[model samples]
Structures are given as C-alpha cells and as structure tokens.
Target: MKQAPFIAVEGPIGAGKTTLASMLAEELNLPIIKEIVDENPFLAKFYENMDDWSFQLEMFFLCNRYKQLEDTVTQYIDKGNPVISDYHIYKNLIFGERTLNGTKREKYRQIYHVLTDDLPKPNIILYIKANLDTLLTRIEKRGRPFEEGMDTAYLEQLIKDYDDAMASLAIQEPSTVIITIDGNAVDFVENPEHFTEIVSYIKELMK
Candidate 1:
C-alpha cells in the first residue's frame, strides 16, 4: 500500500516551526509531533558553560527525540495515520555539528544513526527559511528565558548549516518533497489569507 502522508515542518530556532506545524496539523486533521525543548535539565547550564554541558544536553535531546520518532513509527505511521511533526530527526545531526567535536561528535553520530536508521521519513518537509533578523525578532518576541543573551554568531552559522543540510537532504532523498517557505515575506500567523493560502497549497500537495 502507498505510505500515509507524513509532513515535517522544519526550520532554525525562532523560525516558528512549532507554530506552523500545529497549524498544519489542525488544518489537515492530522496528529502532530512536537519537539521537546526547555525540559532538559542541562539546558540552563549548557548556556552558562557549553564546554561542560554540551554533551549532556545533546545526549538528552538525542534520546528524547529518538523515542518520539520511535513512537511516531509504531504508533502512527505503521498504522496508516497521516502525521505532522515540528521537527525531523536530522535536527540532532545539524545541532551536533555545531556543539560537538572530535570523538564526542563521532560517538554522537554513531548513536544518532543507530536510533534514527529505522524511523519513518517524512513524505513532505515544509522548510521555513527566514533571514537572521527575522529569526532574532521572533526569538525575542517568544521571550523564552533560556534564550536570553542568545549568541547571534551561533545562530547565523546554524542557519547556514540548516540551509546546507536541507540542500543535501533533497539530493539524498529525492523521494521526499522539500518545500521551502520564505518566513520573512509571509505572515502566516497574523494574515488569514496567507495562512489559508498555505493550507490550500499543502492540501493539494497531500493528494
């Protein structure tokens, strides 16, 4: 049988990924998988001393994300339920590249691949691409306490890395549909017309 539609909304931090994903989930009447953030005990300390806390933070996220994806497969995808997710498993790899180094990174990758290798891939990836200023503004508006004094340099590099990874992912997984949306130009949250436009667009694609 043909696979049930799996839509994954992905973007750099503060790009409103969860917002868009939830909206899509509601519009499409699909179950939504949201990422676990801020629950990490090491997150606050990681910001204070990245060298000391990077591995721990990363491991916590890796394990949590793995379990979420695992459940996504057995609980939803395998049973033919269409699903929408705020993140793709590849996010661990993207963040790991920036936070990890040497043997730590190598081992992290080993663990990542082991956990994610069997997980179901998204049939459609809604990639929200926004300018650095736009991302920063949104991040500030959200006012997550953990994000205070965020590193712009790190954010800039992460954006580049995400874009690069998306490019590679498209080439690597030609069967997956990759749709990039300009977050700077579109106000999906406040503009009803824009939101409806996106909803209509994605509905057509789902067929």
Candidate 2:
C-alpha cells in the first residue's frame, strides 16, 4: 500500500494559510481538512480576554484537531493523493504555550503527546508569512464579527511565536520538508503562476 501525501499550511491568523491551502488543494486535486475554528465557542471571548480564556480555548482546539485527524488520516494513508490542511497539530502547543503557565502548559503537552502519538505528520509544511500590518489589513477586510476587536499587540506577539517555531523546524523535525512563502508578496487569488509554483513545490516534495 502506498502512503497518502499530506501537506500542512500554517501561520499566524490572516497570513492567508486557509486561502492558500484551499487553492493548493484544488490545483493539485487533493482533499482538504480545515481547522474547526468556527465550532469553537470560546474563541470570541478568548480574543477579548486572552488572559482569562486562553487555556480553555487552546485545549479545545488541541482535542478537536486530534479527534478530527484520528478519524480522517487513515482514509488518506497510502492512497497516493494528497491531503491539504490549513492548520497542523503543532499549533495546539504553539499557540497554547503563549498563554499557559508552566504547570498548565506541561499538562497540556502531556495530554497532547498521548493523543497525537500515532498521528501522521505532514510530508510538507508550508509556512506563510506577512507583515503585521498586512495581516491586520486582511483580517479587517474579511470582517468576521468575532475578529472585530483583534488588536495589533496580540497579532505582533503571535507572529513572533510563529517565526520562532519555523526557525526551529529543521532541527526539530528533520524528516519533514518545511517551506516558507512570503504571502505579502504573492497574489494568491489572482495570479495562477503563484498558485502553480506552490502546487509544484508540494508535488515535488511528495514525490
């Protein structure tokens, strides 16, 4: 049996991870498993008061993502076609660590480890990055009601964390191919060439 190809597109909010992942999936004829952010009831409150709701929100996401992947990953395994995802499993810990205290973070990691022990890691991780200003603009333009109060300070902190994670990806997980793209520079929606280049990269890595 052949292994199914898996690709994860990750970044801070509004970095175009979802848009790019959808485009890549369509272009490459792959199915996609998107993050379940909309189902998270605490998200709006968490954004409004990170100090109060961060841990709960993060745990919810961690458990939800794990459950979804467990149910879906086997279907794709060895099937030869790729599965494109907007967010990866690591985001649970990546974003969780930002708000969790030492003890709470440790506990979250322990649970996360056990839950994701057998899950398939991505064959390729596409990291999309844009300037903070660019992300803010995109987020505002999309106008999700929950995002109305999102502030620059929060976004800047998240961007810093994302960069740190990608910087360590090579040494941390040498088996996976990690690719960084400048989303601010790409016309993902209008330029077919840009989209094609991304799809080509994923295809090459899968091969």
Candidate 3:
C-alpha cells in the first residue's frame, strides 16, 4: 500500500527551516505549516528569563505542535497527498530538555511521548546542520526582537541535544528515511543554487 506523503525540515534555530519549508511547499505544490513561535504569548518573557519561563514556554510549544500534528494527520488521512512542515513532532521534546529543569524535563518527556504516540512520522526528514558562528550570524540577521538576547550557551546546548537526538533516532529506527544536509552551504533565502539543491533533493525523495 502507498503511504501518505509527508516531509519535514528540522534543525536548530537559525537553520532556515521556515524558508526551506516554504520553498519546498512551493516546489511540491503543497501547503506549509511552520512552528507556532508567534502564537506563544510567553515568548518575549521566556527570552528574558529562560530559567523561569522554560517550562511554560515548552508547554505552549508542546500544545501547539500537537494541534499542528492533528491537523496534518487529518489531512493525510483524507487527502492522501504531500505536506511540508518546518519542524517535526519530536523537535519540541528536543527543545524541552534544553529549556526545562530536571523535574519539568521529566514531565515534558512523559507528555511528549504520549502526545506523539500516534502522530504520523514524516516520509523523509531533511536535517540541516550548521556551526555556532553561522547560526548566531543568521539569528542576528533575521532581527527578531525575542531573539535579541539569545544566549550562545543556550544555542550550544540545543546543538548538543539535537546531535544526541539524531544519533539516537538513527539507532532506534535504523531504517527510517533521513538526509543530512550541510546548512552552511545552503542559503535558501538569498541564493538560487542552494535552493535548487534542496528542491532537487526533495524531488528525488518523492520519486
């Protein structure tokens, strides 16, 4: 039986997930779903005091991601076509561990595991990797107010967590479809070759 087509572009902050998602959607003639960052009412405060607002911020993201997944899952069941998203369901948990404290982290793990139980996994994941300097530069270039005081320490920790998660994911689902791409080489927002490469890759995946 042919499975529903789903594609995800996942990476740490400033990795261009949103721009890539949008471009992929355009090329594939699919709708785009991005992270609910703007919807988070606590994001500004969370940026100011990560320790205090980490749990709260993560909870908001968890809820938002679940809802986003629900919508996509429904579409897959009904329409049986392609969809592209900026982030995957489990990426929320990745951020959760980096942001939440010990006790809250445990709770986050439990909820994340439960919420993702029946969520549809992507047919292919495009993982973008970039160094800290590149990431920081991209973050600043974007000029989001909430990202103004972003700490390098927090970004570094997220990088480690993302690496650990991808490594474990490879182990747990050895056969899962994945493609690791170097973000440093790709400028989806500015250049054409990088965007062409990404679109080409996704086309191959679809075939």
Question: Best-fitting candidate, measured by TM-score?
Answer: 1
How much lDDT does each candidate structure score?
0.90, 0.83, 0.83
Point out the higher-scoring one by TM-score: 1 or 2: 1
Off by over 4 Å in 2: 1-3, 78-81
Which of candidates 1 and 2 reaches a greater lDDT? 1
The residue-by-residue lDDT of candidate 1 on 42-80, one tens digit each, is: 998888888888899999999998999888989888999
Clashes of each: 0, 3, 0
Q: In lDDT terms, which candidate is top?
A: 1
Task: Rank candidates, TM-score, best first.
Answer: 1, 3, 2
C-alpha TM-score for every candidate: 0.97, 0.93, 0.93
Q: What's model 2's TM-score?
A: 0.93
Candidate 3 lDDT by residue in tens digits, 1-207:
555668888889998888888888887898888888877999999989889998888999989889888988787634787788898787887888777778889999999989888767776788888888889998999999999878898898887887788887777656557778788876777888878887887787778
Error of 1 at 120 (Å): 1.0
RMSD, candidate 1, Å: 0.9
The window of 10 residues in a row where model 3 has the poorest summed lDDT is 168-177
Model 1 earns a TM-score of 0.97
